[model samples]
Target: MACTLLRRLACLALLALAGCTHSDFRPDYPRVASTVLPVPADAPLAAYATRVTAGHGSDSGLRLISDSNDALLARIALANRAVHSLDLQYYMFHSDATGGLLAQRLLAAADRGVRVRLLLDDLHVAGKDKLLRVLDGHRNIEIRLFNPFLERNASMWGMGKQFAGDFSRLNRRMHNKAMIADGAMAVVGGRNIGDEYFDASEGVNFRDLDVLTVGPVVAQIGQMFDRYWNSEQSYPIGAFHHDTPGPEKLEELRKDMDAHARQFSQGSYAHSLVARVGDLAHEVPGTEWAWGPTTYLADDPDKSNPQADSAGLNMAPQIRAWMDGAQHRLTLISPYFVPGPKGVAYLQGMRERGVAVDVLTNSLASTDAGNVYVAYASYRVALLKSGVQLFELKPDAGRGRHGSHFFGSSSGGNSLHAKAIVVDEEHAFVGSMNLDPRSVHLNTEDGVIVDSHALAQALLAIFADATKPNHAYQVLLDDKDRVYWQGKEPGQPMVRYDTAPQTSWWRRFKVNAGGLLPIESLL
Candidate 1:
């Protein structure tokens, strides 16, 4: 998602001002990084690999990581246990506490002779090139950015000018997120590296989900990472910099990273991870396994800049096939849902054929993306009238049953970020793809389709909890054909709203006004 509207305007002003002062500055575009080091396929994850392979036959071992703390802990464990290599990719890797802690771990892994490759989208790479370049100097570590901006050293205005001239090329982004360790295990989901994603943020925390998998799926994920790592869009950090870091600076960076990791390891968070991975490490018995066939789906990296003649390589068509096979019901959990006319008509047909369709998305008050809510609100009545059950997640969701531990806790607000689909209680999908136009038409996306009844039940249970009265407000129209929000409060009568009751009047006004803009496709 782009920055908040207000922030974007602020940035635009800064860029405009900078262009006046530094119009002559120009930066060089770098060459691609070296190819990924060969994977030692025979090197198994010490204690974890045997259990995933033995007794499971060709089936993959799948486990869900719903808790923010646990999800981060799983990543730390996988990194700590990786033997041969680690390939980590993300759209955002903030230099906050979480990012710093993981950076420390990755550096240590590299120091120990493990090859580590980090690929990130260029949208968030502004102002961080120097720091990343220092890390790239490490012998065993390499850093690359995807589709970087050309005027790397330009002032804000210079950037704005460059963006203006190259809007279409710079607008498309790589929104894929995944982490593979030692070719033996992988974690894929809706998370980016930040304190908010791992329950450490005091502000807005996300209710996100990720899956840890082993077996044949890991190999497929490795291949997907290679495709992007070696793609034309990726460029080495060394290419943008004048030269690699000198010895003194590299030593200082290493020392700072060591101190950060030492401090993090002494904290309760690291202690908890140390305990869980040990307990969770073992062979997953057949009875406990969610055994089934799995298909990994990913849009071609070049799909970000779609060409009419490009091979038909997209995740949408593959996803449509799964939807087509839904025999009973369809459940969707998308944070930024803009099911346009065609999507609505398709769902209507499904309902007509006796299929139950349910959707869970963010309420105007809960959503972090205001413009997106505007676009989605325009389709509310149409979706409801077409027999689609709709629920908007409460800002205070994850407060019942599971509480903060279920979703990451925050004092400011809570919003849905997970993108998943459940079809007919037989299959489930987990990934970074939202059901918005941006995901389908502009950005590169990826996901996994698991044909496991057990996993399906787990996801359905989560959906049930999320849609409960205390967790969400049902969107409905009264007898007078007026749209209102409805939910019951504990020890009180049910409540209703002419508008989103949790949001302030000003916020609602801003969102409604944004609906008038001609940017539904962008949202």
Candidate 2:
């Protein structure tokens, strides 16, 4: 009976694909070309950045934003401080509390004559056309969608049909995340614009990392943004929709968003955040900024094309070079880690060279992507054999605490979302690129490498806090070569689990069954 139902569903899917014409996919749309606006010499942001880096030639200033609320505040502060322009690129931007608050600020900036260019990947913007159209209706704001779907249907069946028709093109995604303010400073890291990323979600929240940078590297980031902004893949949001929302509709959206912001500000969670905005407005001048040589790296936009020479456009090699240069110690923090054979060999080689290697990733119970955990599990024994120290974040890692000095506190389940590498405690890399197949071969990624002992130490401090026994489990191999986990919670005795702890049997079965499939390359 199940097989017959499957057959009927397959037939329906085939018919649906057959019914779709070329117009059902991405259609030819007119897009106007634009470049980054030049930085006005007297702009306040530029002047501030200049004063801070007066003596540091060819070096950038860096500060790590490990707290979720601070991360959101950083972006909001940047948007509010912009006097000339703002360029933002991200994989996902939802319309939740944090997203709406930032959106309201972006609109406020636009109202002040800030040229706002928002570039978002189309995968997550299916039902938000009304909001986007209204924002695009503003003369000072121009929105673009990267690699959009013209059909604008987000249902399960619709996505399946689209995938059946154009699997290769639709599978490729732009995974880069960046926000540049007035061509003077930028923030780059693993965060997306959403409530969970900012600790405002009632459910699961992500512990992420971002670096606010200024000086020479900002120009490099601007150049990279321009390359993507002018690429053939970017389409003006107006091109996808035929009609623009009228002024009345824009005003309606404005009032609704304003009301939401006002209501949110009065809430307990946002009250403290609102109070901190003034300090953030001045870019936190009292905070010590690390000055160092920084190198910005990004995969070319053409990497979104499956037929493109991905190897030549890849940024993984540059990251590998940084890893290859590690001498004393190396640490990796990734949410979804599916290191293939080459990565295993590289880490083993580092171990052989007497470099202590440590890795922190999500455990099965803490991970949002079970398929990825399945693939990552396949190489655990090999990685252990290579003498790589492994730690898996606990599901409730950040619960029951106020904001710590390093990682911020959360009320619900916590998942690792920060992607970074620290080498010899003197250099660090932070950005959206995960150490997995999807980040390497499928999606375009970007990051910055800062050669600063202070920055590296700060990142190492975060790793230290996140990998404590209370916050994470140390993966180990018994004398019989069996995998086990060991950890202890605050005021509790040590515990051991032969299987993934804090997870149900059904979840374990699903992940183990998924491991049997030959889908590692697509992970």
Candidate 3:
């Protein structure tokens, strides 16, 4: 790929740092084979904004497409179909089956003379940049790294390391996963470039979701890329990537990718991806995409984001604003739910009013991030005491561990990775911003304040229609004068628990202990 002079300079800077040959580390890219899929003729977010040309012509074209399972792959395939350009930005890009499949698709797109640009965070490049370099050097592809730390520079592991660490910038990370194709359509949401993220889960897959748009929002997605691309903060991988061994090493990687892809092709996740693909694209026609209002936005380290705040965006204040502003109901879904005292108070206050509140989070045994689950476990009493509707997904649920469903069971593997809020179902906010402290106070989050009745309703409709069981549990005082609980779903009757937590002794210890740790500030 023809890199810019600025990119060349960055390459040189990285080259001056330390690295070795690429044959040393196993690449993270996985693979997934071909499959059928459904397609959605969803409208872009910008279509509803002010118009200059009227209809789709006046709009900015398709800006984003969000989906879990097959829906995500279908959108990616659409981008792969683009002959002109492809731009990708993400925090992590694994070398797994799904990852390799996407890579193959991108390479195929590149073969069509498309301009391919990839920007990835440096945090994950450790011992793996060489394989990426081989691809980055492709005639039609260019890659860059953001906020990298040169690992080989340390003479030993002590003073040199400390000195280099001081000089290097590694505190912040780029967590956005964005894709823009041909400058006509874009996808801006929470999925990173990985197999589990894109539905290669044989055991289970992330129950993640994203938003897609076709309209002027394309400009926003592209603009975000343009800004980050040209920013000094981004470093080119050319110089940073060390040399690779002979074709033997390359062949080994290729073999692993192929095998992984074969595995996923037979997995349930691949089937789901195929189905969603067909659903979203088979019937759409004309210059205009399906119609609805959507917003494309980007959140960096800004004064408004909690990560940028000096004292941090305390859960109390931010939630109070969101809750105090709520006119009807607030529904929050976070895989990892940790509501501090302020969150409890805010939700309680909302309950005191006429507002209805509901919360969805992973069960203790089901959560992949155990620490966060612990924090959430500790807050159970606080939430139940305040009269909030609480739902805990069963460990065996499809959207449980690893975000995938039971292999042969009628389960949904995709977990609730959505960081969203439905306020009266009239307006919603969907983005990488979780309700947890890390999102509100420590991590850089981004989302748009969507003001569209149709879109909000549609999203709520999805939340409602999906038979994804929501087990509601209410805290109770038993006749024995001890606290207990009952769990109920839509069709099933209530199941009682001897203890209010419905958890094991070990699980309780883990969560409560995690709650008492000093690292609550970090997710």
Instruction: Write candidate 1's Cα lDDT for 1-523 as tens digits.
Output: 3569878997787566545432222246455445445555456473456555677667786777778877777787777777778899999998887888888888888888889999999888854677788888888888888877755654565567666656677788889999988877788989999988887777888889888887788778888888888887787767665566876777898899888878888987667666654323234454555667777778887876644344675788789888999889999999999998888888999988889999999998789999998888888888888789999998876555444345554455788899999999989999999999889888888878998999888889888888888888999987775789998765567888887878888998998888889998876
Q: How accurate is candidate 2 locally (lDDT)?
A: 0.87
Q: Which of the two candidates, 2 or 3, achieves a greater lDDT against the reference?
A: 2
Q: Candidate 3: minimum summed lDDT over ten consecutive residues — where?
A: 30-39
Which digits, one per residue and each the tens of the lDDT, describe model 2 over residues 118-146? 99988887545679889999999998888
Off by over 4 Å in 3: 1-67, 152-171, 242-293, 301-325, 398-414, 465-485, 488-492, 498-504
What 10-residue stretch in candidate 2 is worst by lDDT? 399-408
**Candidate 1 at 281: error in angstroms?**
5.8
* Residue 18 lDDT in candidate 3: 30
TM-score of each: 0.90, 0.95, 0.73
Q: For candidate 3, report its TM-score.
A: 0.73
lDDT digits (tens) for residues 306-412 of candidate 3: 23445532333443454467888887767778888877887888889868888766665456776887677667766776678776555444332332321122343
- Residue 500, model 3: Cα distance from true site in angstroms: 7.8
State which candidate has the highest TM-score: 2
Instruction: Looking at model 1, report the run of 10 residues with the lowest lDDT sum.
Output: 18-27
Candidate 1: clashing pairs of residues: 15-156, 15-157, 19-157, 51-283
